[model samples]
Target: MQLDDALHAAFRREATGLEGIDVAVYEKYDRDPCEPIIGLGPREAPIGFFGRDPGEQEVRWGEPFIGAGGQKVREGLYRAIHGAALPDFEASREVGRLAFWANTVPYKPLGNKAWPMAVKRRFQPLMAAVLVDHWQGRELITLGREAFLWFGINQSRETRQALDAFWKRDDRFETHHDTPLQLENGHAATFRLYPLPHPSPLNQTWYRRFPDLLAARLESLDAARRLG
Candidate 1:
């Protein structure tokens, strides 16, 4: 399926599982075209980042990530990936590979509440399909523990052990800490998975090392490309 089609499917699947969420009064934001907030690249890059927004539903135009935590994420992506003081989405595409940006719970989280476990669980398969079908199994980079956990990698003791080892070693790529567990017909192999602490202000401790961690991950990607 095409990327848009796959994305829409995933969105619908996720939305359907929210029956118990009391979304009657909640406003729904229309899916807008993915635009670069900050440089010049293909209007259609395939890589993306997903998250949960814990606030109001109406998203402002020209703004992607929508809160302090989101701002920090943008900062991390900019400084770590683009080597910039602030994010320039246009410039980001020039350096690293990312085509799109999305969220599992695309709408801002209600009352700063965590997403329901059922909603998260139901959304994962659809999310995995979007990654596999649309991006044709391109590289993926997910931030936050929740996203990692949703991807089904958390169930593996080996993967958890790897993450722990990487943490203890204070490794750059943290290759030991995270492993690429395949999903949906080996789509997971197209890229690597880097699960860092959430960029939310709550996790300020992780921000200090964000750049270094991202840089190391990028280097590994480059190395893998060379080897291939």
Candidate 2:
């Protein structure tokens, strides 16, 4: 089967088994009038980006990151890879070519609210499947704290310690970017995680610096891809 079709079928099968308050919400927002926001890019892509969840724009467009924050990410990636600025709201085909993009929560929330633990737990396995099984991604660039924190919560105690050190701005993360983690599906893998502040305009503290950080990470990812 084609990769995208296979993934959709897998997601639908998983959806059938979900049960909870969020199930109703997931069903309501993930079908018919709304479309499930699946990840974009080739399965072989070495770099993947994770975001918290989709907004209305993403739900409507059937893409992961098309909102304002996404624009910043795409712009930065384009600058890093091609050394030029990308036009705002360029189509997904253009922006998504740089790397794979997914979200911690596949379904868009009603008001773009944070997904409850119930929702996160339910979809964690599927998220792992997409990133590890389907994409085989080696590096993950997480957009916000909540996105990467989920990994720490479900990972080993040793990994949790490393995450804490990274949180405290330890230099160890810089020297050894890769960390071993166990996905919700019991898949063991080593991933280089580039945790960055959200590119939302509301996050004024890192708003200006986000582009530089993203560009640097993209360059690093490019180097790694070449080496591999």
Question: What's each prediction's TM-score?
Answer: 0.60, 0.80
Residue 64, model 2: Cα distance from true site in angstroms: 1.0
Of candidate 1, the 10-residue stretch with the lowest lDDT total is: 33-42
In candidate 2, what are the lDDT values of residues 127-157, reduced to their tens digit? 7766666776787888877876767656679
Over 4 Å off, model 2: 1-10, 13-35, 91-93, 170-176, 183-186, 223-228
Cα deviation of 102, candidate 2, in Å: 0.9
Give the per-residue lDDT digits (tens) of candidate 1, residues 1-228. 234655565565555545444243242444332211211112345434555533442244333354555555555455554445764644433333333454555444445577777666555555555554455434444566665555453235766565545545543337523355455555554345555556665667786776666556545555223211
lDDT (Cα atoms) of all candidates against the true structure: 0.48, 0.68
RMSD of 2: 4.1
Note the residue pairs that clash in candidate 2: none
Model 1, runs deviating above 4 Å: 6-10, 13-58, 62-66, 79-83, 87-98, 153-173, 176-191, 222-228
